[model samples]
Target: MPSPRRTARQADLLERLVALLVAEGFASFTLDDLAERLRCSKTTLYQLAGTKQDLVREAVKHYFRGAADAVEKEIAETVDPASRVQVYLTTVAEQLSSLSRAFLDDMAQFPPAREVYEANTRLAADRVRNLIAEGVAAGAFREVHAAFVGEVAAATMRQIQLGEVGARIGLTDSEAYEQLASLIVHAVSS
Candidate 1:
């Protein structure tokens, strides 16, 4: 069944909810806390989702959805296959720059939110693979195993999201992503 369309007010509330969670993390926020922070009532929050956990999950999904759209939009503006791959990863990094360490830790602890991130990572890997394949076909990149590169990139992204990369290398997730983009572009260049 089709879901009911969101009203402008609900959309604005959701955007605000996403920004607040991205800035501060959601695990520490109670429904009442979200209500007060968002300047809405608990009942209004319930209209967005049924419970606090669901609300957090919804916000995480919303954040990724918006990020995906933004990445694609930027990629569309770039013509070269190599540049597309670079643009894709760098845009992803930019989108993720807003995520606080607290938010990453909270996502790791929350299975639903963690799963959303995992699924998004997998999709991004596929996108990288496609972009690399395009570069090879276009002669913008040398012949290399696109799938292997994509999987490696995906693994790095997972570690970045998990905070393992930062713990070991002291690089923020965004920095790691930018490095990954550069590495992939260099590796694929003819």
Candidate 2:
């Protein structure tokens, strides 16, 4: 196990990295930029997280970890699978809406960041899959492929985050979430 001090340092570095990613977007920063912005040396960052891709991965993971925590909390608190899924989707929508446009604009410029983003997406999909599987076992949801429903739900969440179809349909984030939740419930409930 890592020492407590080392763990704390890693946490601090991750926090700083996340703030930088959120503020300037991943494309706006190089090793030198991060070194200057965080007042640390490139060597230190290298020691902390080998490559830029690694840094991006860690930062993206940190962001999604927080999202997952929220989803977990929602699951623990909600008795019904449908309500739990709605809370999870709505929470994600709210988070995406709160993200800085600069963050989104910058994210567009980085392929690695996109990859990291997609990985987090799969993580979210797995969470939804687990939820669906549990619901099915409890007879709250009809017999269906949990993985397929999870993938669709995850893709729908991404669509909302990207504001592609949701904006075209004149749906606010909450409205889009409700619509998605309704569809998910209809598809899964017996």
Give the best candidate by lDDT. Answer: 1
Which residue pairs in candidate 2 collide?
none
**lDDT of the structure predicted as candidate 1:** 0.91
Score every model by TM-score: 0.96, 0.72
Error of 1 at 11 (Å): 0.7
Model 1 agreement with the true structure over 71-128: per-residue lDDT tens digits? 9999999998879999999999999889988898899999999999999988998999
Worst 10 residues of 1 by lDDT: 1-10
Off by more than 4 A, model 2: 1-5, 136-148, 158-163, 166-179, 186-190
Give lDDT: candidate 1, residue 137. 92
Candidate 2 local lDDT, residue 145 = 92
Superposed on all Cα atoms, the candidates' RMSDs to the truth, in angstroms, are 1.3, 4.0
lDDT of 2 by residue, 37-153 (tens): 888888878776789877776676677667667767767888987666666666665655544556665554566666656666667667778888988888888899988898898
